[model samples]
Target chain A: MKHMTLLAGALALSTALTGGALAQTELSLWYHGAGNAVEREILVGIIDDFNSSQSDWKVVLEEFPQAAYNDSVVAAAVAGNLPDIIDVDGPVMPNWAWAGYMQPLQLSEGALDGFLPGAIGKYNDEVYSVGLWDAAIAMYARKSVLEKHDIRIPTLDQPWTKEEFDEILVKLKDSGEFDYALDLGMADQSEWYPYAFGPFLWSFGGDMVDRSSYTTAEGALNGDAALEFGDWWQSLFTRDLVPGTSQDMADRETGFIDGKYALQWNGNWFGIKTLEAVGDDLLFLPAPDFGNGPKIGAASWQFGVSATSDHPDGASAFIGFAIQDKYLAAFSDGIGLIPATAEAAAMTKSYAPGGPLEVFFGLSEAQAMLRPVTPGYVVEALEFRKALSDIANGADVADALDAATDAINADIARNNNYAPAN
Target chain B: MAAVAPTNQRLKTSLRYLLLVLVGAVFIFPIIFMVVSSLKPDGQLLRDTASIRAFLPVGDISLDNYFAAFKRAPVGLFVFNSLLVTGITVIGSLFLCSMAAFAFAFLEFKGKEIVLSLIIATLIIPFETIAVPMLMVVNSLPSIGPDGLTWGWLNSYQVQIVPFLADALTIFLFVQYFRDLPKELIEAARLDGARWFQVYSLVIVPISGPVFATAAILKFLAMYNQYLWPLMVTQSEQFRPVMVGLQYFFQLNTAWGEVMAYLSLITLPVLAFYLFLQRAFIASIASTGIKG
Candidate 1:
């Protein structure tokens, strides 16, 4: 069956190629990094460089802004017109891989051993995708703002308990310099929820779903620890620690920049963008774990090759070059991410300027957890996050969680409940 | 003349001028603010109100924002694509829709009422409902060639242009105008032994200037502002249109100043077109004061 499917895919791809009027060997690559013109220019330069550097294949770079990238991807897939290469958020990788929309990588000798272990995953012992880079959510504070309150910087490695976090909020409130002590964002969970709340749920040792055999314990939505985490989060809004308005996401970061909020939870990506927007008065700290669980922000993105690709070897080779020690260092230098490869990460740490790169690179091993890499994670995580929002808005934490749990389990069951064979 | 006193006329003119100035200020203030905001630095964006001095840039006012914006993506390519698509849409819609309207209005075709009813029926169904199937048709076009395996047709102007060739609303607009047109004129043309095509091309088209102008204006604006279909069909930035390009600009919310500048630039052409067509467009719309 696998052989027949492979042959069919090959036939379809060939027909798509020669079916065109042109005789050129065109490879379609879809990307979602066109949000900024600067970023778009960078992407275009990469495609142009690749085209100029190779003779046998011409890479056509297609981009949609991140907001519409996924819809476009799925639509393209439904039409049997999936791109030859795709760069997607890591959470969606498993679903696409499981649905047979993406092809697994068959590494050349020593290629499998080169990347960090946790960065790769296998289903049925076949590696599906590789992490291009690592991203994590952490707490950010303004140095001057903290100094105004005479508060010493909290050690990130140490997980602050619930009581301690509340105390810091009280201190900031009493200090009278800011309107809010901490910005516990609930407004736009689309971007901030995965990074901010995912870690919070994990800090209490809660999993969003139970896939124990797959190493994802499914009860994160229904469990007591998750409920406690929700209650504590709700208190932030209920007690007026964070605004309840829809503008909370952008408002929180801007407030922190304008000295309105003392502490904010955002990922390392925000760190670099913030630095560019408002210079380096920002300091990073690990999300408070409270000792019950480890602080783990959600992973950001990974690069993968298409299963239907004609030049898988070349694609893998290009990924290697894109994340090589010097290239990784240069690419992630201002981007606020730890390099996925150990050698690249260490080199970045040793040479990263002004010490902020060290702050990000240091968190790789300190206290972090990955978002569940399961086939139903995207559907499960979104519904699960929406349940969190309802809880934060004073809905019954347990009931809201139960519904999310049911929704996730239903999705998992619908995806054929694949039990990975050892 | 006896009933209209000079005093009353003077008062009326004053009231008209007053209303005009008030409405003008209402419309112009936001544009003024946008221009000012584009000139301001990043920090002043959320400041609610910026000083007039903020607009001058004082060694800080640079074309850097616009330059950075243009450099960020293929703005030039998008502009060309947009011009090509929208320009063709304007011409196609004006000619084809007007012809169809002339048929519905004057020609005694079979099932004329039924045909008109069916055409109007399409307008009732929302475009969103049919967008999915329409998109499938678009994607499958390249595969419809003789060999049944090609993709060249999917991304070209044909895919973009064909689905939107005959809009129901445009046909409706032309039909309404043609119904109001003098039937005597058509009879006179026929009496001169002119064929139906000659009558429409020469007589009807010449006399129906205002209606055609209105249809052209409306079609140009709709196609110019279209974003979603092009975004789906176009594979690469090399063929992306201007609306998609502007959407990408706004997506980078981190760079507000540049977004504002790019927005200002994108709106300029639309504004210029509106200005050029204002007189003709107004006459065309106003001519519809008495319905058929």
Candidate 2:
């Protein structure tokens, strides 16, 4: 009975895909954008165009807003009511992959090469998801503020040494033009902490766990470099620059726009909003690569095909089309973010008659660090962020790191015991 | 309660009024913020300070957000789905629960006490614990009539309404109310050669207006506020309830003005219903004893 029911479901899915009326394949795509008017208008037009361009398949667009996209998608998957395509973040790919929610794409035919080398690995051995946008982390500083204070930021191609970065912060502090020399959103441990601060630990040559044993009882929190970085991060609070609201949850964008923050640590996705708010006053630079370790940045959004989708072929083709040069260019112009494919970089330049976007894109390509693409990475990332936040608020560094390590270790044991390929 | 001097009582009453006003303002602050913020442009949603100067927007308030929200999704279809699913769930739950309550209260049956215990026991088990299993059960059922003879129960009004049919809490409430009824009246009706079903339909049901009203109001609110289950069952906006629709609207659109407008729009129906039913609830309460 179950088999027969599943067979009927399969038949129904195929019919839905094939546009049962036209007998053309119909595929439903789910995305969690539409935060602003620009994204909503652009995405709708793109889907409509995709639907009209084909005779064999018509694409249906469904949106889950960023706020509740994760919960909604998980619920949809549990109910076996998944759309043909979904836009999942890089950190979430492993969770979906391990849970058997994503379908592996047949990308052996040179299709995988179109993406950055390490990008596909985030989705496990099989190419389970395709990169949508380059959400590389970078710094945005107010050029006018920096210039008025006679402070020059290090170039996009150059790495800022620990001494140089500190010197600049000290200089800004002394200048008194801004309330804080930098606003990295340190107080909001749930979000800004892990992504903004995790790279610092890595740059200091510290690992969250000793990969050899992968056990919390035998973790890497005792390492000297990790403890040193933890203390340095805590200093931001000690210095009284980290703003604390009733909940210590304040918006970084608001701080920057109001001229309270001289420098903002965020991803490339905010480029358009920053531009719209402050215009040429914004200067883009790579996330400061503190020497002696790898530059760690975030890999942002990706598109995945649902395991239940009947139009995998057309969906895959649409994934390719969705990131095409023209659409990417137009989207980049409208949203001030990098295009998915490298080819769209040229178009991005053409769309914006400015230097910052291209400079930021180049820096993004060079220093981007793919966040750990493990199942349940959100839990781990969040715990790690909490450790840093605790340290920032004067908690013992060793204890905080130990607590985070214990949490991530437990998460790994429960969710992903699979030995990693890399 | 304490007895007070006349002057002290006057002071207490004034203080009570002041306290009520303060509490009311505190409760309504967020809603007011949402409404006012929605009127402002995107940039002003999170302004640093609120002053009388900034209470109203500088630019003209526009209905563009509402227009954009409707154009973005099928709002009409959503309203129809909400009406259909909520109406069916409310009505179906009322009838099934009342009948089951009547049987348990008045009829003789084997292991009646144990069965009643089990039915009530179901209420104690938190729905969260069984949500996964319950969803699997719902998904497993075909929405169409038996064996492809009709549309599978899924994505259908019945599928959306059926699982909600047997609510234990509702049954327990109805059973308690019906058990208190004067059995001689039901006995008299049955002795007149009326069928068992006829007694329930013609005599008992007609006299159970207050209890019926109580059950209907509770079910209506539950069905109206429902979000997750309806979202799971309905594949299209054409089958979504109001809460799910409004939530999706808020998610897709961040411009506060549009969100507030849509919120204010959807909230009216429930608000109106509540105002209409307030009289019924009050009257029912006035007549029923404290225990009932």
Candidate 3:
């Protein structure tokens, strides 16, 4: 009986030790890169590192497809089932934070210092999310096509002026060497509308919403500058200088590569593929200057802490650990985007100095601009998309802009101008 | 003139066949394109879209995209999850809904008409309208599982299965079909020593193949094509279905070839299922005039 009790005590002690070794608190993370094997592999590496590198927390990943990610997160938030760590789109981060789906990140004070401004998700003076890389848009063109046409290759400092870019498109169209002068990716009707085209509006001194007040888009969207931007935008389609809204998606993917389109206004995510196709002749030019300095849409997917997380520190710790320069470079190498910092850029194969995709890093540094940082920006972006789609289909530019302005203003008023919490 | 009439009849038949072939082509072309595209490189697949070549199995053809798709996502797991969820839901729905229909049709109950009407009224209310509320209710429901009595139902097969077992549309389909069943069959069964349960199992279910097939197909399609609810509820990849898995192919630079390959793979089960039940489903629709 005594021997049996001793054996039981030893068994209990062994079980306790095993339990203690497995006591790392599990922190759930939801990511929006479910199908991207390269991204998945690199991210799994980061998660595994963070899990093993610490004693207090172990992060578990749940990945959703990017298309369904936002709605899923919103629904999970409604059910109060949001995971501890969530990755959000950079522009949409404000809306999520406003909806109380996310909390301000709790990384160390200087952790974000060397990161690109676009890589940092800031709203109301607090950073709520941080991305490992920033995406930039550029004019994808063939150097040979431009040189053959005798059009001067523009630099970051001396981007083509609005008038020069317009004339170049006309010249290319008149040459009849291509089916179209430009492919604006009109087939993609989602956020691509606002992300790629909004920068043109900004260069024309117009915006989706008034940044100073975030209350109404009256002057910002329908003002004289906006009306001018809209006219130019519609003229591209009406004149057949660019593909219309009904452009086939397949055409958008292959037109430029097949030499059916002379140029494509696309993001850096396609930089590597285009480079492989066009080889040494490919160029990533800056967005044209239209009175204001040249600009390209900035920011990409980013990681943040969910507001309901009972373990914010652990969630933030994982995020902080994941953003180390090596990991950032790994992500950049795996997927072609601008690394978040110069240090990380130096570590990447493509974004490194004198590399093939080095120009994108420079373009991102010199010209990248974040979309309006407000909760109302989501509604504002939707209205902007509709307005642009209408204009492309030959609606009166002034009428489209005015309609967008009213809808945006109404939305802002409906939500009490999306007042921020102190 | 008799010869002319015969010739004209032949001409009319030829024209009808031509129109039928055209309509069939219109429906079948997308599937053909998907299968053909899945076997080609992304570049060739995209290039072929402009011509009749897209429908042909010519040029740079291989199963590279399908292989890449598998490497990219756990395609088999997604298919299994979808099939399992769909299979269980269809079986459960057929049984429970048919039983309810049996009771409504054979047994006299109080407020029967009003109750059936209420259940049918739910058909008009979109699932999206009540998705969030339903999500909350499911999250709070108690369940005994491997963990031994869990409070929430998130990230589990039962979560995907249980809430969908007896949706209103499936019940309505069963009720409509059961009502149309000859009352004499029920009367004869009751005149025997058989109980109501025995009649349902031994008699009504056996002769009700057409309705059962129709309901099974409708339920299977509905459950298999579920996107929003699964997206909202299944946070873990292990519980995600094929539709949600389809999203994995749409990165910033979407892999069109991979998307087509995934679609082709997921579509096989649906095609096989429909083909299996199509004869009975058609017969049911012809008799009942109920369009699914």
Interface RMSD list for the candidates: 3.0, 4.3, 0.8
Q: Is candidate 1 or candidate 2 better by lDDT?
A: 1
TM-score, B chain alone, candidates in order: 0.87, 0.79, 0.96
What would the per-residue lDDT of candidate 1 be over residues B1-292, giving only the tens digit for each residue? 8667987999999999999999998898777766666765655554434345433434345666677778666777877787788888788888898889899999997999899889988989987677667778777665555676775445667766777779888899889888988999999999999999999998899888778777777777788888777766666667778877775664424566777777777777778877887777788878875221
The complex in candidate 2 yields a DockQ of: 0.20
Candidate 3, TM-score vs. the true structure? 0.96
Residues A1-422 of candidate 1: C-alpha lDDT, one tens digit per residue: 99999999999898987665254467777878775644455556666666666555667777776766776676666556777778767677777777666777655556646554445645556766665567765678878776876666766556566677778788887777777887666556675565557767777767686546543334666787877877877777777776664544336547777777778776676776666655777777766656475576545566677766777766665554444455555445534466666667666643254455466555655666667777777876787678877876788878888888777777767656644322
In terms of lDDT, the poorest run of 10 residues in model 3 chain B is: B167-176
The lDDT for every candidate, in the order shown, is 0.69, 0.69, 0.92
Q: Which pairs clash (backbone N, Cα, C closer than 3 Å) in model 3?
A: none
Off by over 4 Å in 3: A1-20, B1-5
- The TM-score-based order of candidates, best leading, equals 3, 2, 1
Measured against the true structure, the TM-scores of the candidates, in listed sequence, are 0.82, 0.82, 0.96
The best-first sequence of candidates by DockQ reads 3, 1, 2
Residue A186 deviation, candidate 2, in Å?
6.2
